[model samples]
Target: MKKTVLPTMLSFYAPDLREQIEALPEGTALIGISASGQAIAVDLDAEAPHVLVCTSSGGGSTTVLRSLTAQFLHQGAHALVLDPKRISHLWAKGLPTATHRGNVAGIHDALVGLGEELARRLDLADSELDAAPRLIVSVDSALAALRQLTRYWETFRSKDDPHTSPAVAALEAALWTGRAARVHVILDGTPAPGVLGAAPHELFGTVILARVTASTWQRLAPFTGPAPKPSRHSSRGHVIQQGESHETQAIWMTDADVVTWLTDPDDPQS
Candidate 1:
């Protein structure tokens, strides 16, 4: 008798992935292709609002960040990249509308500046924000940065200062009030409860889980309903938004591909 064989689910990558990127609707960024051959994307303005990517080490979170950042930047938004490890998203270095911070001190300063900017925007009317450029803060590793920031504050905080780190407070503020200000954050990390002053799902509108276990999802994103089973295919994950789960294979982006977005003269066809 022949042994029973189970068919493995195959991941799809478009041959014209760049074209798919070019064709993304305004305010939407192409994330990847779904298992059923649909383009998976996130709307920065409305649907997603803000994104939190939860994945284990080497789970391709940086790739997702780069793809999203490239599209947002192409659409005229500025980006602030907080990469304490200093290795991810090297293509962003020296880009005109983008700034990269590698050290914990610099990351803290950037977050503080972002908080201040968010406050300024909150004072403006809706018409003013309509003409204002959007801002994306891409944190490569939220957990690591939070740990470093806590230690940094502990070492240098004055007695008069509050016990909690101001940087963390600023981040929490942004999470709470940034959408109306056109300031959005795309964070990739394994964050625990209380780290962000709320549950992960509460802080971010869109949560992308990559190569994470079912328990991780249940704990961090119970609001998304039951988690998808683990897949043998690489680059597979679920994008949970508005209570629906969309299984997807994340877009594969090379550094060269991302650089074009920075230098391509704002023309998608160019």
Candidate 2:
């Protein structure tokens, strides 16, 4: 009997995030690098519209997300970032494409507004669909935000509030019906059962796991086979979608990169 060893990070000739973004065609989702150094790009319009990134703190999740956000903005998409900690998304604060940014309270309002916008788009006929801009709602530390929202709800539950929890309702609405209206969500955090409703799998089309414990992986994706154990020293991660899994590297992005991306070439001060 031989002991089974899971795959770890291996050397590959993958290009960095900037190169991949430059090479990909407009409107394609840059899904990072495969173990064999292949660039994974998906057409969101034709495929799944939402992504959930699961990882512990300092697990390179933010790097992956910022890379995706930059690519989205470069390709003419509007972004709304929810950063309860107010640190993860500071780089996007003044960007022209960043329509919204702040703590959980702001997130709640933004989602509600987005829901209304989604409704407006849904009401439009097919000929008017081209006027809609692709919307990306990026939530950093989603689990933390959900926990905070829960705490707030508990504090106010005794008052007999008439309206539904705005945060949860907006999130649920986006998860349920925003796909067809060109609205997509990107959540980066640990996956906790019952936090994002009974069945989170139905809400997200793709899941990315990075430097997480085996137990956590199993809990989130029990149907999949053994999760790949990437080397802690490397920037590798894994993506699961449609019953398939692939080893990948969450591309790294820096504050300088973000600043460069957001700065307008024509305006020296931008």
Q: Write the per-residue lDDT of candidate 2 for residues 4-77, one digit (tens) a residue.
A: 33234322123344554666776676766676656655555545567888876666777767777777877888
Predicted model with the maximum TM-score: 1
Largest lDDT belongs to which candidate? 1
- Could you give me the TM-score of model 2 versus the true structure? 0.83
How many Å off is the CA of 199 in candidate 1? 2.7
Cα lDDT listed for each candidate: 0.78, 0.69
Task: Report residue 83 deviation for candidate 2 (angstroms).
Answer: 0.5
Cα misplacement distance, residue 270 of candidate 2 (Å):
14
Task: Put down candidate 1 lDDT per residue, 1-270, tens digits, no spaces.
Answer: 222232232222235666677677767887776666666788877743789888876667888898788889988899999898898878889899999998989988888888888889999999998888899888888888999989998999999999878888887777778788888889888665675667776667778897788788887678777777766655567888777677777776667767865587465543
Over the full model, what C-alpha lDDT does candidate 2 score relative to the true structure?
A: 0.69
TM-scores for the candidates: 0.88, 0.83
Which regions of candidate 1 are displaced past 4 Å?
A: 1-14, 223-226, 265-270
Error of 2 at 225 (Å): 0.8
